[model samples]
Target: MSTPEVSGALAPGTHSTGAHSTVTAPPEASTFRRWTSRCGWALAVAVPLWLAVGRLLTDSAGSLTPVYAATLAPTLLVLSLVALAVPARRPSGYPSSRACGILLISWGCGIVLGFTLPDVGEGASSVLGSWAGPGFEGAAAALSNPLGIIMLFMAVLGCVVSVRHSAHGDGSGRPRDTEEDEAQGTGYFPVLDV
Candidate 1:
């Protein structure tokens, strides 16, 4: 009797039984990969939450900056969406280079928007108050505020990380060949008996 052929990968000793064939799943990700993936997901989720809370606080304090939101919120929303869309794990060396690049650029733009956009009118206070003190509202102080400095640092860090991930593939050097079994002539492609 002729045996059936199965497409794709099969575990060792796996065989077709009449009409059914067993295929093994890919190997589990390493602990470090899993942890980093979770962290990425968590940070993606936290961005929106942080934005909402900041808005709420400003609204409550009667110092809401709609102009800032109009310009900066959209940028932040784009950043969050891109971050979420980025895959936590890719197929070995086939990293999400394009997505990472977009993320890096968007983050840099957001930082620039935050710094250059004018905060006019009655609600022009920084999160950490004025750099010259709570009552001082000078342009130099506004531009050199602690919050802006912190944001610049964070944006730089995020860009660096994205670049590294795109180039290094999770810092694991080159990607492994996932088709090792097939390369070794072990791919099960049994022909079905008539």
Candidate 2:
């Protein structure tokens, strides 16, 4: 009897009952990749533009310069996203939940790093409020934007979300990395039945 086309893998010694075999269906891909790609592209463009704006505005002393840390923070996230492009260069081929997870964490780290850097004059530390304090904005005053604020929120949220999500996950709401059984021979992509 001809075997059935299975979408999920059949148990060992379990044969399809005449064209009724269960084919193991590969797990669904993640949507996080979508957000990752979007965020990366956005930061890549926005960060540079903002940096330029910061330089232009801060041409003179006490002219409202952007926080150095802010520029540095988004740059790290942009680079990470550029490399991963929503988990992997090709989203459909492989779901790099772990890579994506790491990138998310990196994004959060970048945010913290940005804040840690000096927020005063060129190479000045803001920990002591180099300029004056809240009363003294300093030459390199912090710049704010709707996009930037959103990005910051996203960074924190990404970190929180990644606690459960992982690269090996099927994104089908199943336990993460349990799809080792889903992996086939060869590279990162799961082997599809031809």
**lDDT, candidate 1, 1-194, per-residue tens:** 99887566656645555456454433444554455445445544444334334434443222345544554454455544444344333433221333344444444444433333333446555433433345433553455455444544454444444433433334333332336436656554334110
**Lowest summed lDDT over 10 consecutive residues: which window, candidate 1?**
87-96
lDDT of 1: 0.42
**lDDT string, candidate 2, 1-194, tens digits:** 99876467667645566565454444555577557555655654554444434334333322234544345444545554444443343324333455455555545433433322233346444322432454333422242343345445555444333332333334322443334544634343334311
**TM-score list, all predictions:** 0.39, 0.38
Once fitted onto the true fold, the runs of candidate 1 whose alpha carbons sit more than 4 angstroms away are: 1-33, 48-55, 58-64, 92-118, 130-194
Deviation in Å, model 2, residue 36 alpha carbon: 3.2
